[model samples]
Target chain A: MNELVANLGVSYGDVLLELSYLLAAVFFVVGLKFQSHPLTARKGNLWAAAGMFLAMLTTLFLHKDADGNGIALTNGIIIVFSIAVAGVLGAVIARRVKMTAMPELVSFFNATGGGASALVALIEFSNPNNSSTLVTLLGLVIGSVAFSGSLIAYGKLDGKVGDIFAKWTTYLNLFLLGIVITIIVFILAGNISYDSQKLLVYGLLVISLIYGVMFVMPIGGADMPVVISLLNSFTGIAAAMGGFIYHNQAMILGGILVGAAGTILTILMCNAMNRSLFNVIIGAFGGGGAAATHEQGTIKEISLSDASILLSYSQKVVIIPGYGLAVAQAQHICHELDTLLEEKGVEVKYAIHPVAGRMPGHMNVLLAEADVPYEKLIEMDDINPSLPNTDVVVVIGANDVVNPAAHDDPSSPIYGMPIINAHEAKNIIVMKRGMGKGYAGIENFLFFNDKTRMLFGHAKESLQKLVNEIKTL
Target chain B: MEQAFEFFYANKDAIFIIVLSVFLGIEVISNVPSVLHTPLMSGANAISGVIIIGGIILVGHADVSKVSVNLILGILAVLFGTLNVVGGFVVTDRMLEMFKKKK
Candidate 1:
């Protein structure tokens, strides 16, 4: 009886930690599967979050030091304070920030996350205790990359900086990276004492931070989604390093899972945008000049009432939505317009490019929320064919995705990325604030087309006005 | 049946928390927009900030010999990952609110 009891005495905490990890993994799988369809996305998110929490809890409870204490009292205090500060700050921001600043707020948070990681690495190197060559090297690479990369993404998303830095910026980064590498080599050469090693590590940490900043500084606003994914991957890798440092199985497994998932997501986002990861990086490398915004002075314009008249007579219609839809919070109104058009016996379908909004499938979610039927939400492949059959394509605050670079200009920033081909439709009606360049800072050829008519205004107001005109008709 | 019951008795805390968190997380994410993938991810990138505090605690408490360096480095890693999580959550929430109709 005692032998059986002893066999089972292997402590419940370890078993629980492993079990929690399993649950977390399950949640990750479910969350990822639900990403393509909005109907299941929220559930998917919750699953992923649950998984993360499980992983975090496992780490919290399972960690044991040499003295047999579960976690030091100081460690517990730190955790409490960190949670309190972060939770309060998060709540305040959530309560106070306007919908218009939501995207910027999100970007800022991402940057802060990256900065925290890099700072952690710095503190580790600064410490007199727990020095290992392998752990230091891992922290150096992952922490630095995540920190600078996230900041640049934040800057681009906020329009604080443009993608594409000065021509020499790339070279400068290369030079800085080289110095850090050489220093690492020197430390590993076995000639340096402990104090010297600390200095070298500190120097490298500074360079790593700069590298992270430089990496993101040049990426254009349009590619922020991909950059975010890439940074997420870096953070995961950094966490994995932390796991290795602490010899924590849960952290290692969780970090690796996050890293792998983030890498896959970044690739998918890049593919959807029809651009290579290399191009995204180079695009971020800004050249010194006037911003690369597309502003054509010569496009013909039309009134909403005239737009309504044209739509009233058109045989078929395609509706294209972009960030402006989200900004204007006009998705429901847009859906209303679509319904009215369909009622008039004009066939209507929504055209969605993969990278249409700030996120991968943004337009679909916003439209779905507005009660647009699932079948009406057409992907790039499905909608392009219908564009030629359509008599009118009403573009609501979309720019880069409608630009003709996919068909005509090879040198353009958004070239080769799949677009909605609204230009091929008999008539185009674009509702926008003005002829401002999109996230890519390039001109759209669709605006210059004879069939294209700019219905200049905020998407919601303009859409409301169009709805009124349609009702009158 | 005895082993199963015994396992449940021994690991009740772990099982309960895991199950409950999974249920809660699933419920919250079910309503958020799929487009939030990007912003959530970016926000997660921000959560990496937590690693910094983790590093500080780890290093500050570590023995001044072998693990000290590792703790400090670990803290950095935690910082980055934490930042990502915090930021990711913030963005996810913001993106979800976008679906909410304007007042």
Candidate 2:
């Protein structure tokens, strides 16, 4: 029956594999598309994930042996166990990690992917029967470079290496890279024997690792997010090379898509940081003289009830939550404020920056838990346009993401990275217990913006008071 | 019928790897944001680096008739693999250091 199915120009396995790939691709496209806008982004992600699951299941079933038994059952069991262990580790980290460290964790994961693909290629190459053609060598070299490069990027992102290394490592790396390439070319020209070629490959990998280390050493902590995106592109390219060597259409296509998407993101991140990709690579001029210290001037503190009353009267209110909101677990309170505003026919939306709340999507998950309608969550780009229309931008424990220094002060640590334009709103209301610097340890200029008002107290307490005032009014 | 089955056996490994990687990739995409992609990629790269182990195993059992070039290449691949593993650990350890509590 299976043979008949295979011959009738209706190979069920191909149909299933193609369908799975199609679905995964669809999901990838949709999810990535929605990532730019927070409104429908969560649903977009769920859709993408559903597609991926379909792909996984279909592909698994298609890999059956002639007797319809699954191939490598023992290997499959081992894989499941490894995945379980990894899952536990990931969950533990997610639960325990603060919002701030989320980016570094993401960087860690990107490094892992690059390393995995490189290792896979290496294993394949070790087989004597495998062809040692240019294609195989290309795959091996590219994958190795990406693996080491991404690991170094992860290290730098974690702040294990100082920003100064990013400053001076570029030229030295370029010099070494030149030597590695020269040796590789000489071997390829048959000027060296087979042993020499092997030595050259090792030399290439060593140079690549050193290059990776030097590449990321100089970048400032502030620019880590962009670096993560760039490294992600490298991983995708390495995977594609593996795909090429293996002659898998799905791997090649999927890898190509990821590589392209990652590259675009890297460019966008670079633009956001206001630095050319070249400059970021060289780790030019990280930190110092950029952020101005505000005068320890009189800070007027408003009560929660007064703040709530002020918020209710506004035609439009934009809630900006920061790390403090995450620390206080005030997402639910913020959600309540949104509901009350909606009941009063007031327009309410939450403005979120990419790096807002410590992790990549910390604010999204927190707000999602509070049952905040996904559509009401606004990303930096969308919120920037709406800030002018907004009557009140109610900042809940936010600081760095809203700092105007990104635009006005080139000397600040966050000079070029994209930020939420909450300062552009008609009125800015900040809720905090006291004046403290943001993650970058800099005072916020938005706090002193002419239209800004500081409401001093715990974020949840303040929001609850505001909710009460709205209820009464 | 037996010959048809033999063809399947001959091509099974290639088919298996292709099917597995694609499926795993889809699962990864569906369940998580690309944020975790880095670690996954790095892990895979590390696995590919295991070619060095394969090389060592092959070299240990290699017959005298085998090309000396293969042996040299095998040694080089092993060296690269070791460097990749060590470098990966160094970098990852440095990154994990960020989570340490500051005095």
Tell me, by TM-score, which candidate is best: 1
Tens-digit lDDT track of model 2 for A276-339: 8787676554444554454434455666667777777788988888778977888888898898
When summed lDDT is taken over every stretch of 10 residues in candidate 1 chain A, the lowest stretch is A285-294
Off by over 4 Å in 1: A1-15, A18-39, A72-78, A91-106, A123-132, A162-164, A284-299, A313-315, A324-336, A339-347, A368-375, A408-415, A432-443, A448-450, A457-461, B1-103
Global lDDT of each candidate = 0.64, 0.58
Task: Give native contacts recovered, as a fraction, per prediction.
Answer: 0.22, 0.00
Q: Residue A434's C-alpha lDDT in candidate 1?
A: 93
Provide interface RMSD per model, one decimal.
Answer: 7.1, 11.3
- The C-alpha stretches of model 2 lying farther than 4 A from their native spots are A1-102, A132-166, A193-196, A284-309, A312-315, A322-333, A336-347, A353-362, A379-391, A397-421, A424-426, A431-445, A455-473, B1-103
**Model 2, B1-103: lDDT tens per residue?**
6855864576565446545545544443343332223322222222222222222332333333445655444344444433333333233222223222121
State model 1's lDDT: 0.64
